[model samples]
Target: MLLKEPRLNFTDVMNRKAQEKGIQLDNDQQRLIRHLETLAETLLRRRAAFAGLYLWGQPGRGKSFIVDSFFAALPLAQKKRAHFHTFFRELHQQLNGQGLDAALLELMGEARLLCFDEFHLHDIGDAMLVKRLIALAIARNVALIFTSNYPPRALLANPLYHDRFVPSIALIERHMTVMALNGPRDYRQQATGHGVFSEGAYLWPASAARRQALGLPDASGAVALTVGHRTLHAASSPGEFLHFTFAGLCEAPTAVMDYLALCEGHERWFLDGVPPLARVSPAAQQRFINLVDVLYDQQRRLFIAAACPLTELVAGVEQEDIARTASRLSQLTTE
Candidate 1:
């Protein structure tokens, strides 16, 4: 009898496992995956195409999982995958020793196939830097994959603030094939129902509960929560949970910096109410979305909110800001 041979198509196996894992390997995703597999196979055969894939979706849509799994299946020497925060933090830290340009150039040079998870920007300060890094990545012909809640058109929204990086946005659009994955139900909803999430993960503590939990001293005055030695004054109200006057935080209205400072030592916060704004402009709303994005990327805290559930709080926000906030809030659930 002739011996039977076992044939395996790794791409097919990956697609099957991806579907089984509840990832939304939809038509677009499947197409992209097939294209990617083709590119990889081509590279193995002839090393011709320098392929890049940008995967985007709202939170809970499995952007991270699919890209990560895909990269993992690739040969170790051929891939470099990084969380967006990790890349920035490492780049920033390296600046002390190698200088900014050097560090960025080094990172771009190191990765032949790069995957950036939770890619976003709020502060225009970082926007220009991102623009430069992306340019370097493309120049090197690196096969890049980025996972973001926002699609490519929204990648660098409010470019007026990032005027210097307009060219960079143009470059990213030029290089990447942007794809969006939308779903019928939130995957996080299933997790929440199963008790896979811990209540304290994103709980926004009422002022009273926080004070009691931390054993803070009361003097009939506003309570102070310290982050990296910076003090945020919050008031204690009965049954209101830990309370903060939004106006106070936005008094000077330095949106990004203040929240960065406020969230310095913690990953999550429990906000008591919607920000105090008589009429919120699109810019201001974007800032709020940025704040949530940063907090969620850190993945250290979960918010327990009172004014609204996560979805509604960001729903009425303008079109530009909607994707950013909804993408983040979509991952959250009420405890």
Candidate 2:
């Protein structure tokens, strides 16, 4: 496929976008720009052995910012970008019905450039599926870019599964240019008047006066919602915004798929009765983390009514993405 050169160069585009937000790109982020420029040059000349760029860093630090710029500046006709978990969830939905060969072909329609944001894995099941996905991408000559919180070697780090993942990690190291965008500052945690997400709030103590003042409905009754084949019972709402208790949203058998499906129907979400992370079961804690990941990535508004403050709500949780969940939660208005 013939690709046209983008009118603006990668650095200039990144700098301009950063300036627009009054963000002075830090040293590491600037280094990322230079690497992206080199990668951009390679991409423009068509595919190479090292066709993909793997970007990883701590929570925030502008990984998403740079990826958004790079992904936007590319002038490829078949390019596709998606959130990591959401991408696999949809891919698995197809895989269960049609198998990998058909699923890969169907999911990745054309797409020379594939950008996946917030890429990481906890489950060995997802790790296996991702290995095949990478193979398919490389075999099909898809130029790939991934923004993740962990380096390829550190992904799926369970001792039992880590060895199984080495081949895939080796494949990643072999096929992609890896760069770390580490910096002292986490941009997402900064209160920068970011739209939509900034407008959302995290209200503590779950007070009636606060809820009444915000016009938020209470979880007075239970309502059943059909998500795929499962019937999920959430708290009653006034039909203006969707409302659910922490138990309903995370304590039971809810998964990322349930959040993805429900998110399509509702934009505004209310999660009340949230206790400290230490108090909840690990499964429930993980489900809440997944919930926040979906809502934040999509820029959906989330109003959390918790028993404790924001810091306490996420404190001492050692999940792989706990820092990210903290950074994202920090973005919301706290009352």
Candidate 3:
């Protein structure tokens, strides 16, 4: 006896998930779903021959949501999805004792389709690695899908050194179809009063009520969370919320994996003493930006008590990326 192949009904799966999540797909979202359905069918018929998709838009525009829906609907066994930071962290670890090509092949394993969320380039070192990785993945005929806040030209948009990534950009353009999810609605802001953290999510200037809601008792003791070989200490850990000073989480030598572990461990997170961008070191600012990216990608709720409004948080070289963090912060509900 032979088994039957699963039905390739992307629309039905997407509609079901949307209904369960109480999401009303907007016109732009529906159009993207249609495109995803078409891509899914094409890939199903010709997995190796099909080119993939590159989706770009501003933060909170539902790029991740749409891609996630499509990825979840795919019935193939050879698909893998991961946040870009996590993927690269693991990639670097794999590269320590092996060549780049060998490490990429190992990382991909038997996966034919790879979905990367929050794809962007900032570090020169990472750019070099990604160029190699892209070439290798395309050579292996891996169908690639990515969600990013930047289109191809805007990636690493510094005028001083953007040309270094031209080869990678060209490869991407040749192998993938780029589309923008330029929707009118900012779904993150529209998510007010929806989740457990919605009640007292965003708190600025550290008011007494905010302190109380964050469970910051005067006699609270220090708490620590261990991730891999490193331990992250918090100022206080009371009830479901873990509280930290801005310096403790971002200014410290914390990595993306540490932020991911923190999100996994705590239901609610509170960060106090968030100084203005002018006051933070460039390194600390970058860490803060990465922290925000992790939290947003994981859909983890955070309560921030900052010195100034979100708009005035970063004023230095990282102003562009920090602006995205501030946008996400503003969308969260405040007490």
Candidate 4:
């Protein structure tokens, strides 16, 4: 009898993960898994003509879940996975003195497959950089895989400046096979029944009693958090929970790495004085969006006292991205 080939496809791995995690694979997820399996097979074979994949969908649609599983199951060794924010932060730092080509070489060293999670476009500077990076990566035959909340057309959604990013958008459309994971269920919301941390771990309009419950002190004072060469001030630092006013955390020129460090150092976070989304400047609003993404990805518990409910917290600008933040916030408990 002939020996059977090993079942190493993306679908097989995802199905095994579902079984291990006690999750039932939905039809939409199964379809995505099949597509990813094909992509993985091509990459594993190092096909010269293979293009990359760009997976996008609404928040909680399992785009990240499926892509993460596919990346983990790939048998190749020259692969790198990074959250887009973290990747860009490092990329920008590396590109300060070095040219784009040199930066790409250093960043992509020994990595033929680049997997970027939560891919997005906002700043014009980043857009220009990404456009060149995409061209170079494609030319060098690096297989790209991205999971994002927005499609290529919807990226850099600033109405007045959207056209400026057309080149980058065009590059993505031309080089990557865009797929949408339009699943019906919002898995994050569905998981809320399990418990806060296991489900969402978000609290909105945090009340006085809730603050006391979390062991926040009656008296609050400023505390300094040192990240690298910079010192960030928090409104309150009681025990393991670090508290910040919305302005203090998002309005300043705070780096993504600072928020990442906070997430790593503390078990819980508290944000007070969260004004209506419309009230904040566009830059600050963007910072808040980034904060939510980092917090959600890190699975850190968040407590916030907001001026409006989550539904009304999102402003008209960047509605798609802010909607994702709102969706993730919904998983958290509100008093």
Cα misplacement distance, residue 56 of candidate 2 (Å): 0.8
Can you give the TM-score per candidate against the true fold?
A: 0.68, 0.94, 0.84, 0.86
Off by over 4 Å in 4: 1-7, 18-28, 192-201, 315-318
TM-score: which candidate is best? 2
RMSD of 4: 3.3
Off by over 4 Å in 2: 1-7, 47-50
Q: Sorted on TM-score, highest at the top, how do the candidates line up?
A: 2, 4, 3, 1
lDDT of candidate 4 over 1-335, digit per residue (tens) = 98653334677788887787667888878877887787777777667763688889888888877888777778778999988887887887898898888988899998889999898887778788778878888988898888898889988888877899987888889889888887787777765342333333334555677767766543366678788789887887657677888888898889678888777678677777788888778888888988988877777777777777777787565545887787778877764
| Clash count of each predicted structure | 12, 0, 0, 1
TM-score: model 3 vs. ground truth = 0.84
Candidate 1, RMSD to the unseen true structure? 6.2
- Model 3, stretches more than 4 Å misplaced? 1-5, 12-28, 193-200, 217-233, 236-241, 261-267, 312-318
Candidate 3 positional error at 271, Å: 1.2
lDDT of 1 by residue, 28-106 (tens): 5676666667656644443544566677777666566557666766654656777675677667767777766798877
Report residue 8 deviation for candidate 4 (angstroms).
2.1
Best by lDDT: 2
For candidate 1, the 10 contiguous residues with the lowest summed lDDT are: 193-202
State the TM-score for model 1: 0.68
- Candidate 4 pairs with clashing backbones: 202-332
Question: Which residue pairs collide in model 3, if any?
Answer: none
